[model samples]
Target: MKILVAAAAGMSTSLMVRKMEEYMTANGLVGVVDAVSVAEAKERIRECDVVLVAPQVRFELAGLHQIAEPLRIPVGGIPAPIFAGMKGEEAVRLAQDLIAQAAEPTS
Candidate 1:
């Protein structure tokens, strides 16, 4: 899964990206995760399987969904505590769960 991690300015998210990268490598999860600005996230939405927004920027979720829903990309907000703790494994699990939820048939 190609996951796009986004923050307001894209600067602070680098550490989170590194943690996620390390986690993915350690767990043998094959995927490219990119940390980007909200603007860049929108621009690159089409290329990612899932978009994970930083807790600080959770307000942007609605705007992101405007793009993601049409493209069928699963977009969700990272829990603030988990993100602050840099819990990459948990974050990835949350992302995967969002993808799975998106795949389910809605009644």
Candidate 2:
């Protein structure tokens, strides 16, 4: 699966991508990840399994979800600390959990 991290400038998310890559590598998670500016995110969203937006851009959450929902892909914002700290593995785990939850049948 592919994950896309987006932010206003895409600079911070780039660092987050590195952390996530490390976590994925260390944990043997077979997935691809990338970072992009919101403009680029529009084009990249179609290709991703999940879309994580930086907390700094929470204002864009609704619009992003609208686009991603039709694709049946999940979208949400990562906390500031997680993004700033670049905890890549945690991000991957988070995405994995979300996917699992989505696949489950609710009561």
Candidate 3:
């Protein structure tokens, strides 16, 4: 799985991505996690399994959904608390949940 994390400048998400990477390594999960600006995300979405926007960029979610929904890619905003605290485990779990939901057949 490839997860894309988007933030305003993209720099702030590096730490979050690192933490998520650590969690993945400790848990024996294999995947790629990248940090990108919202602009970059538009072009990179196709390569990612999940897209997570920082709380500061939640306003961009609608625009991202416009691109991701058609591709069956899951896009979500990281919770403010989780983001502010740089909680990687929770974020990873959230991404996993989104992936699971996307795999479910719609009723």
Candidate 4:
């Protein structure tokens, strides 16, 4: 899976990206993780399998949905607890769960 973490500026989300990357590696997941600004996310959305919006940019979730929903990409906000030194594994699990749900056909 390809995961994109986005914020107002790409720099801030770099930390989360690192955490995500570490989680993926440690968990034996095969995927790539990238960080980008929201504007960049718009262009990169189709390339990603899942999109994670930084907590600080939660307000932009709707816009991200506009871009990702049609693509069937799961876009989610980083939980506040997960953003505040919570285990990276937790966030990774959230993304994993979302990816699973996205893959399912709506009944």
Give the Cα lDDT of each candidate: 0.90, 0.80, 0.93, 0.84
Query: How do the residues 46-99 of candidate 1 rate in per-residue lDDT, one tens digit apiece?
Result: 999999999988999999999999888999999999889999988899888999
TM-score of each: 0.93, 0.87, 0.96, 0.91
List, residue by residue over 1-107, the lDDT tens digit for candidate 4.
Answer: 88888887645467777887888898899998887888999998989888888888899899999988988999999988887674567878888889999999998
Model 4 stretches with alpha carbons more than 4 Å out: 10-12
Best by TM-score: 3
Best by lDDT: 3
Colliding pairs, model 4 = none
lDDT of 3 by residue, 1-107 (tens): 89999888655688899989999999999999998899999999999999999998899999999999999999999999998788989999999999999999999
Off by over 4 Å in 3: none
Backbone N/Cα/C clashes per model: 0, 2, 0, 0
lDDT minimum window of 10 residues, candidate 3: 6-15
- Count residue pairs with overlapping backbones in model 1: 0
Better-scoring candidate (TM-score), 1 or 4:
1
- By lDDT rank, best first, the candidates go 3, 1, 4, 2
TM-score sort, best first: 3, 1, 4, 2
RMSD of each: 1.2, 1.7, 0.9, 1.5
Tens-place lDDT digits, model 2, residues 1-107: 78888788656777788888888888788888887777788788889888888888878889888888777778878877777777776778788876666567669
